[model samples]
Structures are given as structure tokens and as C-alpha cells.
Target: MTIAEQYEYWQDVRKGLSRRSVLRAGVFGAAAVAAGPMLLGRPAYADTPGSAVVPFGRHLAFGNDPATQMRVGWQVPSAVANPVLRVGTSPTDLSQTVQAEIRNLRSDYGTGAPLEQYYGHAALDKLSPDTTYYYAVGHEGLEAASGPVNSFTTGPAGSGSGLKPFTFTAMGDQGASAQAALENAQITAQNPVFHLLAGDICYADPNGQGKLTDSYNPAVWDGYLKQIEPVAQSVPWMVATGNHDMEAWYSPNGYGGHAKRLDLPTNGPANCPSVYAFTYGNVAVLSLDANDVSYEIPANKDYSGGAQTSWLERTLADLRAKPTIDFIIVFFHHCAYAVTTSHVSDGGVREKWAPLFDKYNVDLVINGHNHMYERTDPIRGGKPTRTAGVGDTVSPVTDGTTYIVAGGGGASLYSLPSNGPESYAGNVKDASGVAAGYFGAGGKVTEAVDWSRVRYRGHNLLAVDVKPAAPGGTATLTVRGISVEGAKAGTEIDRITITRTASTVDTPAFGSGALLTGAALAAGAGYAGYAAWRKHRSGLDVPAS
Candidate 1:
């Protein structure tokens, strides 16, 4: 049967496959009968390899991905021999020839499981953005779910204008290693193009009490693994390191990196493994590291000038040079601006980069050091509203930028600031610094920015979408919070409609840069003359593997 067929069949009898089909399918067929497990889920890697443990307690998220690129992740055993991961375009067939690879990098840092524990990660690249493909990991055909049959899609490069709408999920603090990671992964199974782990991913704290026991181990109870099975099985799961994730260790592996290991897309941002960037439609996303081992400052100072800064400057310059790159977003473990007593806007994010951000005009900033979700309307140099104080009329800051501290991703809950919302922020800075010449140089203050919002508390996920302006229309930015008030329900915490009569063919190719490559890639990539097709909102389907 085709993958779609398998998906359809599973959808039909997925719940009863175990009770009804197990006896009918015989051994291998009985294993296929795991449609129940397929729909419901699995046992953890903690059990002996393939011990009929039924990895349960997990949920499928970000699965059946629909982007041109997709990332599949899941955990297996340290003892499970010849663990080969294979992927393809359907539930029934899994072929490596479909354009995929496998890796078995281990980790010594984590929570829940004991020491010497290892987790598995495989990052698939060069996929057709915005298309769905099925995958699984294991020896060709065994007597069960080698791992799982999941689906995913790469983020769409965009519509006719190389513009695509993308979605990413947020979660944090997987303190229990594979289990916690898995639990969050289960939630991430929603097939987000990627994820935002506010803090404490992998929980591989080499110095922590449980680091040696459970957090670093593979899976003591499979609960989380099963939970995250869906997300890990598909979609790129991005992480923001908290204090707990930075566990130093002596790895027999080359560079002697930290205790934890991540499988990132080597296909992206040449030579930059952990820190990289990608584009989805008009949004350019840059992911960076913020922890000590990542930054390597024993002083444990925050956001010091590091490789990340250099990369950010260069990346932002490149992005600004191209106007087709409508929006800019930066994600790191520590918040550039935070009201949480637990953390604050580090100098690195403030002094070093915020200026460059102002110079380049960054769109939105997302961070997760604090375990809460807060949204800033738009502010330059910390605090909200450029007016320099609260009670300012809400006027969208065209020159300034918006900030979001969305850290709540189902690990643990956090409290509000001691000073409350209005007071949680530092006294407003030079408002005109937000609006070009408004703030005079001589250590002066001018112009006042309006319209900045902030929110804190609750375990939640952020849903962001990138849509183009109407035919000859203006740019609009929309952000939605899927959970708040203790995961109550999704709410529209922030929304803004930006109008700009700026450059339309603002991309480097069409502008002054390599016009030839731009035109050629545009024509060949199926986006040439795409502006005509821009009137419609539906995304153009593309190939992916």
C-alpha cells in the first residue's frame, strides 16, 4: 500500500489494530498490527531492546510534517546492536535511497537515567521544503516497529515570491534526559518546522545530583521517550540551553564537547553545527548558543562577545542586504531582555547586539532563559514602549522591535516578576533610540515609541505565521500563544499590521547582488513570475524527500 494508504488504514483501525489484527497478522503481521501502538504509542529505550515494552505515555507531535524539509528524531538502546535508521516517503516503505542518513551520537549528560547513557539523533537535509515523507529507524524489516513510522515536511521556501508561511513550537526544561525530552517531544509532534526549548534541554547536568543517575541515562522509564516519539520521529527539534543543559564531561569523542550531543543539519550554514540559520518564506531564523560551555567563560558571565556575536553581525548584514528577507528572529538560551527575577537581559544581547539589531532593523526576538511567556510590543535597549514609561499610548513602533520571552514548554512552571507587569521592566530607555533621529546623540532623549506588550507565566507554546501583504499590500506580523493561564487555551497575546511602501523586489538577486543567480534560481526553483501568483494565499506544493 502507498504511505497515504497506510496512513488512511491506520487512521481507520488504529485504535483496534492490537485487539483485532494482532491474532490475524501472525508474528510480523501482528507487529504490523501495532497500528494501536502507532496511534497510541511505545515503551522507553530503558527496556531491553524490543522487549514488547510498548513505548507508551508519549504523543505524536509535528509528525506528518508538510514542509519541503523535515527532521526525524527518536531514542533507542546503548546495547541495541546494528541500529540502522532508515526513512522514505510512506508508512509502508522506508528506503534510505529516498534521501536520508543516520547517526548514533551518544550523550553522557542528562536527567532520569543513569551515567554512560546515550541518546540517538539523525538530522535529514536537502529535503523538498513543504512536502510530507514517512520514515523509521532500524534494521530493514524486523518483527516490530524498528522505531516508528512517522511523517514530516520541510518548511516551504515560500510562494511565487519565494515567500512561505511557517510554524514552530516552543517547549523547555527536559530535566529527565530522554524521558523529559521525549515528553516534550511528544508535544512537539505537531510537526512544527522546528521547536523553541526555552531552557534545560536534555537535562544533562554533569554537575547536578541526578545527572549521574537518571538525567544523563537513556531512559529509565520510557515515559518521556514514548511521549516525544512523534516529534522526535519528525520535525527539527531546536533547543535553547539552560544551566542544567550545560554539563561538562570528558568525551572520548574528538573536540571533547559537552556531555550532551545534538544531531544538527550539517547541510546548513557551512561549518556551523550547533549555531545555524534558515529561511522560511520571508522570515530569517538564527539559532545561537548561550550556555557557559557554549560560550566558554568560567566567570559565567552572560552573553559575552563570542563567535555567536560575529555570526549574528555577519548574518544580519547579509539579511539586511536583502529586502526579500522580510522578518528577522533570534533565539538563544538566555533572554536578551527579561523581567523574571531568575534571569535578566544580559549585556551580550543588550550592548553588543541590540545596536546592530537597531542598525539592521530586526523584526522579532524570542528567548527562553526564564520559565514563563512574556511579550514586549516593541522596544529598543530593554523595557517596553519607547515612550520611556508606562501609560504611553499604544502606537506600533516602526523603528523599534518586538521581544518575546516565551519559555513555558511543559517542564515546570515559573512565577511572575516581583515587581508586577508594568514594573517588571527596567525604566524605559531613550525612546528616540527606537526611532532613528528621535534620540539626540549627546546622551540625550527624544521621540517616544508606543505599543509594546509583555506577558509572564503558564506552560505554553507559541504559534507564529508569516503571510505576505495583499497584492500590492503591506506587511503584517501576527503572533499567537497556544497556551496560557496554566495551559488553559491558545490566545492572541500580540498582533500588529505593518505597512511599508518599501522595495518590493527587495531581494539581493533582484536588487544589485547576483541578479543572474537570483533570476535563475527563481525560475528554476518554480518561483519566477511568482508575484502574479501572490494574489492567492494558498502555498504552492513542492517536492521533498
Candidate 2:
């Protein structure tokens, strides 16, 4: 249809959609007036006597937290912490009536930038885990809908018996477009128990949806409510940031990603702010800041180098303290290993972060940066292994940690890297970039590659098959990838199953010899992988469908 025809079509659709927030938007007139390249503010509208509670807009809504605690989150007009929270049930389903509310106590989402506290969340304690409950944020008198708009399930109490596999979706770096939105909506349609992201929520290009909704919108957000609504409604959406969702959005220095737009459990480890960790069954999950560490541009610094790194180190240490925690999974926005010929493995990530993971016995590290689906072959120190299939790798006793770069949620496609200096588009480097390489444990970016396999540009999804330890034993963690089209039925191109020994799962036990033994084993096997590598061996190490 012609531009006018399309506009008319959407205009008619908007009539049925909810109206824009009645809140008064910021003054963009002055900024828009003298623009060389115009910058737009969120939808402008006069505050129609707004209520005390932040109104729940379509883009940003709460996700279900899988536990006895409800993860209540909402994107507000500004960074206001005045959202008085409370929970109540619709009379129709008042099976059990229990409610409570709490403020952020200290509500500045990790980014100390001058933000309007775009998102705020509270992990309502004392609720039943695995049980669905109707919840509301803000004041009780205001329109019940004005408060947090949705509800979610708390994490299963503590991993024990009688638990089933819970599903969560993972997507990121989706460039702003109806197609990207539609694909994401499709994945959400799976009705996953939860959804995890590796960052770059929206490419947020110059005319990006992020610009249209302010950074305040992240889910069913924007003009595509139909896409994210169903999934966000039933499942809790979990996330971490990527280069696409840079830490610079609200920055002079750098902003913390602790926005309320994405409903993350503020009750996570550390003063995590935007970064947090939680337990699901036998797994202990750790999500951190990758964007901060990669920011070496003139305008940015390596965020992961300083405080974030310290937090990471401490957090991993803390999770290890938990006894029931069978598997430890770490996720972030940047990929330590890149395969889109356009990008080289983040040697910096290998050198800097690999040691920590090795030391902690972190089973799987999931991230998105390259818009593709690729899994590393049980890496440690940055090296790839020969095989991590069902056999060679132990299922649960001493499985090595695996890393995955899953950045293809539905973003502007990143082409496979042709012969070149590895997707030179945005890798942060100084005159000594390739020379200095990536940082290892001590802020060193040396090329100590000993991690796993990786790919670039494949829009893929992840499926983690977590099987309980052979009853009283350590649990077996299996990870697989699914394409956007075939994801509903669940297809696998690459799969890795790692085993964590009983000793390794128990906290404060200084992870058993599993990490070291497995790493050494995989490292030994990796030599075969190296020999089999395209340039070296007769056969390549590509995954077979």
C-alpha cells in the first residue's frame, strides 16, 4: 500500500489499542527545534491528572518470576520510586488472599545516569513459589490497571523432588521492525515459563522503537503490542544488556542497566541493580554486564574492568556458597567467542573472563552479540574442544562448562564475516587491539583461547534440558539451539550436555575437581578439535543437523 494508505490502516488499528499514557512528557520542543539531526522524545501527551502509581503501558510490563517470591516490575513515566506496591486477587480466583509491597529502598537502576528510573521492580517475598498470583503495583485506590499490569510465578521454592522442566525464551539484538517483533512474538507464543535475553533488545537505531518509546519500553512495547503481549503476560521476561542495548543510553560516563522497563527481580545477588542471579531447580544463574566491559571507545571505557568485574567475581563466589545449587550458569550481553567471520573470538573475553569461570566451575555461559546461534565446544581459558556430545562429555559427573553466543533474536542481520580483520565495525581496540588481545584474569587481554566453539549471524534460540542429578547425584545440563521458524517444535543443530558432580553442586564446597578435571579433559580432546579444525584436519568441526 502507499504511505498514506499504510498510515490510515495503522491509525484505524490504534483506535482499538490503548491510548498513550496520560502523563506529561518532557519538553522536546526546545531539543527538537535546533536539531542538526533531530532527536525525538517519548510520545508527547499532556498528563490527564495522572495517579500516584505509574501507569502500565503496553511496551513495558511485569514478567513471572519462578519462585515463592513474585517479581513485580513496571516501566514508569520517569525514574520515580513512589510506586506504592500491593497485591490483590480478582474475586473470580481468590483461592488464597495474601499481599504486600515494598519500595526500592535504593532505587537507582545500576546506571547512575540521569534517568527517570525507567523501570523498577520488587521481588515480593512470602508468596508461594510455582503458584500464580494476581498482583498490582502503585496505590490501591488508583485504577487497579494503573499499577503493575501483569503477574508471574515465583521460582520453584528450592530444588527438591516433584519439579518438572520449566521453559524460558531467549532473544536479543532484534533490530526495531515489524518482522523482528513478529518473530519474537512467535517465540513468546511457545508460552515459555520464562524468557532470557543476551542484550541488544532493540537496535534502537536513529529511528528505533526505543527512541519512540523512550528507553522506558522494552517488551510488548512500542507499536507492536500484539507481538510481546501473550508471552510477557504468562511468563516472566529476564534479561542482560548487549552492545545494542549499550550502557550509554543515559550516559555522560555510562548508565547502569537497572531500568524497571524490564521486569528483573531486584532482589538478586549483590546490589546487582540491573544484574542479578536466581536459582531454578538445580541451577544457579548469574547475569552480568558485558556492554560495560567492551566499551573501549573514546567516549566509553571498559565497564567490566572495574566495579562490574569485582561484582562478578564476588557474585560467583557467593553463588558457590549455596549448597543446593547444582549448576552455575553465567549470562551476559557480549560474546566471549564470536564466529561470524565478521568478528573474531573476543580474545579479551577469553583472557579476562575465562579464568574466573574456570575457577568457579560455571557450567554454561549464554550471551548475545553476534545475531546468530552458535555454541562453543566446552571451552576453558578460551580453547575449543573436539567434541562435547552425549558420550565423550560426561552427562553430569564432571561435564565441562559451555559457552553460547545467541545474539540473533530478530535484529538487523549481521552478515557472515568475509576475509577481513573480523567485523571491524565495532570491536573496541587501541593501537594495540589485536596486539594486546583480550584481557584474562588480571585485566590482561592475552590470547589464551581455551573455551569452546561459536558462530556469528545465525538467528537462533537456546533450549537447556536440565535433568535432575541421577537422583541425589549432580544434575545433568543439556543445551540445544532452535531456529526462529522451527523453534516452536524445537529443533537442535548443536547440543552440549555437562555434568556437575554432587560435590560441585553444593555451595561453599570450592567446586570439586570437576572444573579442573573436565577442563583438562576437554582441553585434551580439543587438541583433536584443533587437528580437525578446517585448516588443520581433513574434516571440519561444524555441527551436523
Candidate 3:
């Protein structure tokens, strides 16, 4: 089935499942499923040369410093003896050995299928910055041959110093599918130094709202990791949490499963893996858990007790204050500004965080959850600024932050309203000036937004190139939306260049010039051009608190 149809099907199935699905314990209830023979004991794999336990789901992540700290994660089917990773500069000589920590997760609380999963992780520290290292993972009896050792080079240390140019990929809502695999391969082709999954990474949970009744399968995560291993094993795969990530059976906030499977930077709040920040080259990448303040998905709202928001304030301030960090890119799940009907813009995000983005002059805000590719013009104070549209360059310092809904990361494709043709080439803006539906403020709003820059209904991802400014020169960030599937695969559907000067922050007056009048907006003139597409306000149900 198509992704949109699949989403609707899952929505219906979740409704049916919710009627009977009840959590016996929180997300950390590993005991919810009685320990079976496999759960309590290790499985014996034949010791033959090829019979050794095969390691799958090999992926990479980084600590606060990408140059010095690296994290290698993998999975084994069952308990293994002395799981560990060996690394060195040469593939033949793995001189350094680090023991792996196994985190086991048992899933049987609500879903009929009960199973146990083991995630192995190893953290390599004190490494040289900007150096390449080869690595292999295995235990006593079973090891993948040393002939093809996986390897990744560390990024340059900190920001500010003259560093080589670098690129990174960003997307969200990547589930297990051939389309997702295609996107993965295309991303690897881009040769990005790191990749950011804004959120909704691997939709293992059928009911994506993170509600108590959602059904989650822990095994799907295994498939997802293996699915992306081709690229993830080489590039640093950074992830944020989405509504679907909240597995209700695992822990109170439904992130127990995530805690067990992945190891992220510890710079943020105590146990929130979904929220953190890291800087590489000239850019500071910040990942946020939109579920904490998602109007689109309120299941885990405020799960961080205001700490995440408070922390974001401090982090944004620091990034803005740092001389080396020329650009700040914040990524999360729900869109702060989107022009789709399926899951439109989230007002809660705008209410709580958009101001901070404006306050700090954030360069870009990337998000997912809409299952399509879309972008907004430079925005501040809840509307589009003078600078917006394709090929139109704007400095966030004077205009505002540009928001991208790069949700087309291999889930189903969501279509734009029938009011305008899909944007591409020179057709950057909606021809009919239709006010796309936006989900926020505990309801939906149809506003004729001049900020709708590029909207494409396709499966794609965003690759950003960060070029640090030289002394007395300006820095530039180039963002590309690449089509990864269907007839238009490999086409550059959207592109934008943002320039920044050496000055850290530049504040400008709000609502500068020819702004959409409040009267025209209130009279719904924004919806006039496409009256056929303007449906009455519906499907804006306030989620159960």
C-alpha cells in the first residue's frame, strides 16, 4: 500500500487496537513479558568459521567532539560472550580494543508478539581529531573477517579555526522500506560527513502518536538499523525523537527502548537522548525532542519538565555567542512552518521555541512528520519576511530563520492541496496563492502565507554544505532537496543559499515592508485564489491530554 494509505490504515488499526491495548507497565517494563528460555539464557551458535554469531546493525555516532570521540553501535541476535570492538589506524592491526555494553530490551507489554532485543555499543575516546580509523566488532568466537574493517574519519575539532569544507544530510520519518533504503544509498552517495534524522526514525510503533494505546515492535528497529548500515556505518548518524519513537511499554516517557538501543551526546539534560547539541566545522547542530512541545503530538508534552526548553535557551545562546560557530541548525520532528494537509505546521513549537529561534537568529529550522518535502521563506513574528522563495537568498540576521519540512525521508508521500501544481524549477510559489492548512493552536488554520517557498510531494532528503568564512570573508550554507525515488529520483527539487557575515547577531525591525495585511488575512483572501481547495476546518481534534 502507498504511504498515505498505509498511514490511514494504521490510524484505523490503532483506533481498533487502542480499544483493547492497555499498558500493564510503563515503557521500561521488560518484565512485562515473562522471561522465556531465550530471554534468560544465551543461544549457542555453531562455532564453525561461518557459524559464528553475525553482527548486524552496525552504525556510528559521536560524543560532544566529533574529532576525538566516536561511538560504534551494533546488534546481536542473542547473548554473546565478551562483546567488544577493536580499532586502529590500519585494518590489519586493530591495536585498541574496547569492550561493548549490551542493552537488552524485552517487548511483550501490549503487542501480541513478544521478543527480546540486544543492542551493543562501544565508545572510543581520546582519539586524534580529523583522523581516519578502522574498526571491527565481535566477541570471543565470532568475528567478521578483518579484511573489510569499517572505518570513519573524525571531523575537525570545534568551530572557528580554518577547516575544510563539509556536508551533512538531514531528514525525518524514515521507516523500513525499499524507498528508505534508496534514500539511504543516495545519501551515502552524497558522501556527507554526518547525517541527521530530525525525528520519526523507523516507525516501528504503528500508532505514531506516542499514546498509551500505540502498538510497538522492537524488532523493526533491528531491520531499520541494518537497512541504513550501508551509510550509517560510515557516517555519524544523529537522531532526534518523534511521536512514533515513544514506545509506551518501555518507560514512563516511552523512551526506554531508545535509551537501550542508542547512545547519544550527554551534553543535554540527564537522560534525554532525544535532545542534545554538537558542533562541527562552522555549524552547530542541535537536535530537539519536539514531543515535549508538539501540538501535533501531545502524548509526551512537557515530559522534560521545562528543562528541555530551558536548556535550549542556554544552548542557542552559547551557539550564537561562539565566534567559531557561524551557523545554527536546529532539527526536530514536527514542522514549525509547513504547507501540507496531512500534518501541517505545529503552533506549540512556534509558541514555545520559534521566538528563541528568532531571538538568536537561527539560520535554519529542519523538521519532519508531514511525509513530504517543503520549505518556508525567512520568517519572524509568525509571518514571512521580505526574503523568501526559490533562489532568493536571505541572511537570517536581517530577515529571520528559514524552516524546512524535509519529512520525505522514505515514509509514504503526502500530497499538497490540489490548489497549486507541485513546485519545481522556477515554479517556487503556489500559483493560486492558496492558504495551505496548518495544524497548530489546538486546531487548524488556513493562511495565505507568502512564506511558502518550495513544496514538493516526493520522497527526498536535505544535504547541507557548510563553508566556513575565511578571515574578512563571509560564510555560506547551501541546502539541497534531492529526490530519492520515483521518476524524479536524483533531481534537485529545491536549493537555497544562506550567507552570514562575521558578526554574530544582527537584529532588524519586525514586519518590515509590504506585510500581509491583518484585514486581508482575516477576511480569508489568502484562501480566495483556490476556493476549491479550501475545506472547512475539520480534523483538528485536540489530542487527548
Which candidate should be chosen as best, given TM-score against the real structure? Answer: 3
Q: How does model 1 score by TM-score? A: 0.64
Which is better, 1 or 3, measured by lDDT?
Answer: 3
> Per-residue lDDT of 150-257 in model 1, one digit per residue for the tens?
666656644333455456666555454322443343344344666655556544343322111212323332444454545654555665445554322222111122
Any runs in candidate 1 off by more than 4 Å, and if so which? 1-71, 95-118, 121-126, 140-147, 158-164, 174-191, 206-225, 250-261, 267-273, 292-305, 381-397, 421-452, 470-472, 484-487, 491-503, 506-545
- Find the candidate with the highest lDDT and give its number: 3
The weakest ten consecutive residues by lDDT in model 2 span 423-432
Candidate 3 residue pairs that clash: 27-249, 27-250, 27-251, 28-250, 28-251
Q: Candidate 2 at 172: error in angstroms?
A: 2.6
Residue 515 of model 2 has an lDDT of 28
Model 3 sits at a Cα RMSD from the real structure of: 11.6
Clashes of 1: 58
RMSD to native, candidate 2:
13.4
| TM-score to native of every candidate shown | 0.64, 0.65, 0.82
lDDT of each: 0.45, 0.48, 0.74
- Give the lDDT ranking, best first: 3, 2, 1
